[model samples]
Target: MVFSNLPQQQRELPEDGTTNLWGVSRLSEVHRVPVASLRPADSPRHQSEQAEHTHLLANSAQELPPIVVHRQSMQVVDGMHRVRAAELRGQSEIRARFFDGAPEDAFALAVRANTSHGLPLSLSERTAAAVRILTTHPHWSNRAIAAVAGLSAKTVAAQRRKLGPATQTTARIGRDGRVRPANSAEGRRLAGRLILESPGASLRAIAQKAGISPGTVRDVRARLLRGEDIVPLRHRLDENGRGGLNENRQSGERRPPVARLVAAPPPAPGRDEGGVSGIFPSLCRDPSLRLTENGRRLLRMLELHTLDGQGWQSVAQSVPAHRAQIVSELALECARQWQRFASQVRERAVAPVA
Candidate 1:
């Protein structure tokens, strides 16, 4: 009674059989289908485990009319698990139904029987399902046929693509700075005329003559030269890697990042002197001190005679009585000013807390 991947026809008995439902028979008398090449409940893994408990419904239970079959055998194309479960019960017999047909037809009919309720399939899943049915069984229902054709039953839509004729069009920049396409038949005709007649004319001249932008003229002319047959030059990719006119435009190539084009803010305008005002003359003249605020301030303070206009050396010579003390005090004053300027710049750059 055990079989492997039996089509529906092999699993059925003659329709005119003397066997009666009320007649008792050993469960082993029924045919067993081999589990190979069968997926149970859309899950292959769950079918591998043997269940410990088996339940059976009494024959006396009321039920709807049985599914009738016209042929001798009905294959177990689906529901392998249900069949196994029924066999596990200790009862000698189980309620069953049968269909009669060629093994292949029965297998296909079994699949179409819809014995189990399940979730709706996704688009990609439906496509795959359709492919399988079309490849394996062509005699199934239209539902199966369409599924194999990758049609969405709900939407009645197919993924097969259509390519239309390519056309020429003026490509102008819109007021918003994006590319604009021309549409009028007269306009496209005029553009095509100008292109075929004036071979040496630049895009700007062609656009001017056609009352469109130079960019648009260029686009239309290019498409025409490439021998596209449509009025509004549209580009789609075909299987052979050539341009095609289709409902959807070919995917555009990607561009690089925008951050690379910018230079780094000219190193923050190079604090004129050692600070914002450039009052520190020494720091202002030092090229190496441009990026570093601290270095600039140091150079500026050390050259304090130029910054204040009251020459430090001259002042010390004028009062020779404490020349050494005067130089030391002047140097200290310069250091203090530099610190104050540096702090002011830092404070301005740092944002205030909310």
Candidate 2:
């Protein structure tokens, strides 16, 4: 994001020490430029006062507040130099407005902000900003941000990879103020994939597959199924098994969500039905009942048009009893839905497109 605000047109200094610098300076950093760059009109007589005042303002007692500007869109028009100068002074924050300014406008502002009165950004800072902008605006390619920041595409890409997702925070310290890495989400996702693929897998095997410790896998699985955040354990155990990761926990862990289980598909065709060998009646009528193209073609061979109950029974005898029943039901449902859909389509096709 571009920093906002610039010294509004140079005006007479107010009688009071605090003028309408209106946070133009206080809200931002005092950008350092050649003393000669500033106009001589009402300029300080002493060169030392100019630099001293600039330095003092840059190092104010209070933190420089974020700048606020009113514009039609979030665009930086003026004050680019001041923003860059402050940033150079190790200032962490700068403010800018979002307005409907053209791309060229932003470029001019950036150039003027730096060359005219702004402190220049080091090579590293420009590279970081270029990379940061690409990540923040993914639709804009690395080339674009790099072009604006005056860095190469490869440099921008490298910086971005280091930055990772802008929204995701890196490792953070807990309430105890101890720093910790964020692995729970990855751990939980791995655990879920393992549970689906191998329900009977041991915890150790699962953890190995997930690339996390068994204890971590266990905790992640538990918290996920329980709809709780995976958190660090609160206490430690002693030699008596009184604390640590396991001592306080229960033996019988709760199961993961039942929805996580994988369901098995039905047996394929050519299998005996009810100890018989024939095509099922419902299979003859329902196209979807055929799992393969071969089974669909078999419908034409069955003489289903002329054969009623007896013919169907003969065909059904080819399949096992259990398989016959399942296939029959599936075929009937498929035929019913297909007929309904076909009817609707016919009606619509007969009507006007409008």
Best by TM-score: 1
lDDT (tens digit, per residue) of candidate 2 on 132-218: 444444444444445455567678656755675662333432222233333344555666667546766888898777655678767
Candidate 2: stretches off by over 4 Å? 1-141, 148-150, 160-318, 321-333
- Per residue, candidate 1 scores C-alpha lDDT tens digits across 1-354 of 122233444333322111221111111233323333223333212223334311221122332122222224333433343444544533333334444444444433333332111112345545544444433442233333342233544322132111112212234222232333333334555676777677778887777667666766676666554434324433333344333344224455432222111111222343434442344433343333432346545554444444223344566567767577867798799789868987987998895977
TM-score of 2: 0.23
- What are the per-model C-alpha RMSD values against the true structure? 25.9, 21.0
- Candidate 2: 10-residue stretch with minimal lDDT: 39-48
lDDT of each: 0.39, 0.43
**Positional deviation of residue 76's Cα in model 2 after best superposition, in angstroms:** 21
lDDT of candidate 2 vs native? 0.43
Clashes of each: 23, 29
Query: What TM-score, computed on C-alpha atoms, does each candidate reach?
Result: 0.25, 0.23
